[model samples]
Target: MNRFEDKIAIVTGAASGIGRATADRLRSEGGTVVGIDRDPVDDVDMAIQLDLLDLGAIAPTVAQIVDAYGRIDVLCNVAGIGHFARDEDETPEAWNRVIGVNLTGTYFMSQACLPHLLESQGNIVNTASTAGTNAQAWSSAYSASKGGVIALTQTMAITNGRSGIRVNCIAPGGVETPIGEQFTPPEDVDLTLMAGMLPYHRPAQPPELASAFAFLASDDASYCNGIVLRVDGGTMA
Candidate 1:
């Protein structure tokens, strides 16, 4: 059970949802977790308050991690934003916000972490979404961002595989989270975006997705570089 025993990990969006669950799962499995979030988080070995969109702050935060831990074994890019908006309803700011955090943030965070990761021969786990693989109805920005994540994950895996670093992505379908509490998409959007496009009628729990993340990041998946693991409960099948 302690696959990550004594290892060091960085998980973004650890304040809630899939990121929170990932941090918890890694800690429970005996990893030293440094959680990054715009808000505060509990139950992590270290918590760093950070907004992923603030690209200027990224290098310093990664440097702090290296200074504190000496090395990093895992990087989980899970911080992201999502909402339902039609193409016409999507303003320039609205489009920028989602893509900024979900795509740009992930890329820069990985960029900042790569030097250390290369030194440690570590791996990365990025959170993509089923929306990226298929039509996600009204949430065009979320889908596009996730699709970019898939591409980025693959590119990193290919680029770093020779350096003994593995990179993979996880594509989750609809999941229950704090965001669900206020999720009222535009009336014209398909309701399935809130539910899921699968026989399993309920949204997945954050922990369910977190488990897959752990597997991908662990030594058990040493051969899984560049793989896009879909934890979608058959939504894409």
Candidate 2:
């Protein structure tokens, strides 16, 4: 199953969770993967310590990947943060931090990798969330950023399809990861609204969702573009 025998991929947020799972899946299938993360991690062929908040680091990071690989076949934007605050408790700094890393980071990385992706007729698979389309109790900032990612994925798909580059997204509902566990509602925050959010009533394992990422990036999805595939165990159904 060397679906990516000669492929080169760049996966952000590869330090852990879904990003790490996706990287492992691709590498197992024979792709050379360069992982990018804000923190220290050693999970791919090459690991780059990159904080998505640093807009200045995006281009050079892409350049380095391309310089080393000579081509880029896939870019997966899987690194994101979750924010859970009461409406009045949310601050400007907190909102900006979430938006900057999740939405802006996804955009900047896509822009930087577009040239190489176009060259290889590659694809981009972004990690969106069911929170984007559905509602979540304590996730205003997180939901908004994910919703923006959905729109961004569609825009990139439309803009780049003619150039033979594909852009799609996965809207995961409850995935067991560090970020997923980060959604902590205060003691006063009601959990009733969120209780109706998950139909499966269980968080998906990282590797389970990783399979979807692999599918979207592979040639099997050659005709898929701008599609936001929901892997949320009927959460959006």
Candidate 3:
């Protein structure tokens, strides 16, 4: 139960949904969690309202964590935005926003945390999506950004392996989070029809995805470097 006992963790996008769930789960499993998000939230040991798109804010945030916790044992890159725009309809602003938060944010944050993580020989668990692996209609930006995360995870894992740092990614399907809710079919969209595409016949719960994250961050996954663990409930199986 105390898999992360005495460990210091940094979880981004922790104000709500999957990120919030992961933060709570990590703390429950004994990690001292420092959460960051653009919005404010309660229950985190340290919560910072930070906009991930503002890359300049990243290093300062990481410095704050290092100043407080002394080291970061786990870094979960869970901050991201969803874009449901079609290829043609997607504007430059939308593309930038989605890529900025989902991809660039992960890069900047990881870069900032690399030194501390190297000191702790820590691990990173990134929340990618099935869209990263498979094409998602009307979600080009989200898919591309997530794909970048997957690539980034592998690159970091390989680059940091000799240093005893592990990096892995989780590709979740449709989970019952605020982001998932946003994808709900319109009034004209048939729920029954949509249900048939998923093997589980329902969306995943945040806790389910969080559990996978917890495992990846724990010693249980000590050999799981550079891997993409899909938590899509057989949706991609």
- Which predicted model would earn the best TM-score? 2
Stretches off by above 4 angstroms in model 2 are: none
Whole-model Cα lDDT of every candidate shown, in order: 0.89, 0.91, 0.87
* lDDT by residue (tens digit), candidate 3, 173-210: 88877776455343444356454335465678888888
Model 1 agreement with the true structure over 1-237: per-residue lDDT tens digits = 999997999999999999999999999999999999999988899999998878999999999998999999999999988867878878989889889999999999999999888988889999998878887677788889989999999999998899999999999877988865433578666666655544365679999999999999899998999999988777667
- Cα lDDT tens digits, model 2, 47-102, are 99999999999999899888888999999999999988888888999999999999
lDDT score, candidate 1, position 19: 97
Q: By lDDT, rank the candidates, best first.
A: 2, 1, 3
Compute the lDDT of residue 210 as modeled in candidate 1: 93
Question: Clashes in model 1: which pairs?
Answer: none
**TM-score, cand. 1 vs. native:** 0.94
The TM-score measured for candidate 3 stands at 0.93
Q: Candidate 3 — which residues are off by over 4 angstroms?
A: 184-199
Candidate 3 residue pairs in backbone clash: none
Better of 2 and 3 by lDDT: 2
Q: Residue 139 deviation, candidate 1, in Å? A: 1.6
